[model samples]
Target: MTVHTGAPRWWRATTGIAVPCLVAAACGVMLWSSAAPVVDFVYFMLAGWALVLLGIAWLVLVVIGWFRYRTVRRTLLAPAVVAPAFVLVTAALVVVQAPFRLGFLVSKPALADAAADCTYSLEHRRIGVYSVRSTREFDGGCLFFTQGGLIDSVGIAYLPEGVPHLGAPRHDGDIGYDHIGGDWYRFVERF
Candidate 1:
């Protein structure tokens, strides 16, 4: 019986470094996208767990590679480096997401207040009501009211400190006003 132990040089190099590098990049993108609001909540959650799992899998592959090919120690470095990179990337993602989550929490009260004020008025007398809706499409939080409502508007709020320039609420449509100076905005639909 013959036992095959050595892998081809190219195979070892590709698997050791190239594959791990690709995986790490993918994991980083997933984590980043998950945090940046490009992906939905379910995808974000899945990507987060996938990153962790990929890190673990890379570590395991490195260990297996280390044992399988005694001569290709250099190849094992890929996964070795990738495992920690994954962890760091995931940590960074969490750190980046923390503020957004905190901002959402902080802004909830303001949103509720705005919704209440917009929904009720002496003249309109509760013709309609503003309701809290998922802001996933807008990448933050929003309160929306329908037409003929006391106030038909979409209110968007961001982190008070780190307002994202890219996804900031549009001010060109309808009658827009700054609800909280710079961090919050409301766009009232034109009647």
Candidate 2:
């Protein structure tokens, strides 16, 4: 009777990298969506399902490798690390409010273009992290940016004169705004 120590080097390299990378990519998709959104909201759905399915697959593989082969597979080790690391990274992102800041950084170029042209209100325009469903409403108003969602939305706004930052985000009713810097703001429309 012989006991398998672990997967071969080739299997470890290929399968090891593929599964863990895919799971890590799923984590990345979630981070990006939260940090900087995209036009299609379906990506959130797809990414969520991918994490669930991949988790199940990983469990099955781990169980099989352990019970049948009586060996802990080296490929299975990466996810154990990735899952915990993802949680820590997520916490850090929230603490620093990375989403609000990242949104501005990612959309800076487009926001500048929008600022320069008060009349450039185009519907469904996409050039950065998120798509603008209606630059029209914000036209001649403030930052002239919008990432309108069917239910919720995000965009850059401008704080009126003397509406000082006070070092915190301000909220009103169903809408909330955060000061990105200077006179610029990032606003979110709640559903």
Candidate 3:
């Protein structure tokens, strides 16, 4: 076994640390995109930018690592292993909609309580984990609306009777309601 002498920590990091970070950042971007409706859009965009910066940092490290350790190994000069793993994991996430499903599960209870408290109120309020901009009662459940962006909004509704446009992905040009599961449905409007 050939020992790598006079190698800087960053050189090792190209393979050891940077590759893993690159894969993680990619996964984060994917998961955040799926969960964006329930999360703060500002933070989501910021996270995307941060992930871009991380990818750039990893690329720079790999370039320097390759020049310095030209004779070391090809593995250090590329994201060979982690890249394929990222692809496979991303495919799985897309197939299952894991993040969106998880966001629904985690935010459901808090949103249910918020809906209960907003029956007669129209003012902005923070109830438990979710912020409610407005609320409306349906057949036997409630719809809680929250701002996802300046031109976009998302709602977490407990519609046991089912979403109005459950099967239709888009109600009109910019309005839509998509079912999550059970009594949970995602209400999205792009204004």
Q: How many steric overlaps are in each model, in order?
A: 0, 0, 0
What's the distance in Å from true for residue 127, model 3? Answer: 5.5
Backbone clash pairs for candidate 3 read none
lDDT tens digits, residue span 45-93, model 2: 6777887887787666666566655646443456445654664675577
Model 3: per-residue Cα lDDT at residue 87: 51
Candidate achieving higher lDDT, 1 or 2: 2
lDDT of each: 0.47, 0.58, 0.63
Ranking by lDDT: 3, 2, 1
lDDT (Cα) of model 2: 0.58
6-117: candidate 1 lDDT, tens digit per residue: 7666656655666567666666555534422123345456666766666676555556556665534655354446656666766676667653344345555655555444
* Top candidate when judged by lDDT against the true structure: 3
Q: Which number leads on TM-score?
A: 2
RMSD of each: 13.5, 4.9, 5.0
Model 2 regions more than 4 Å off: 1-5, 8-15, 37-41, 73-96, 136-145, 148-150, 160-175, 189-191
Which of the two candidates, 1 or 2, achieves a greater TM-score against the reference? 2
Residue range 7-126, candidate 3, lDDT tens digits: 566666665666677667766766766653455566556655665675576566666655665534655345434644665786587458777677667777777666565474577876
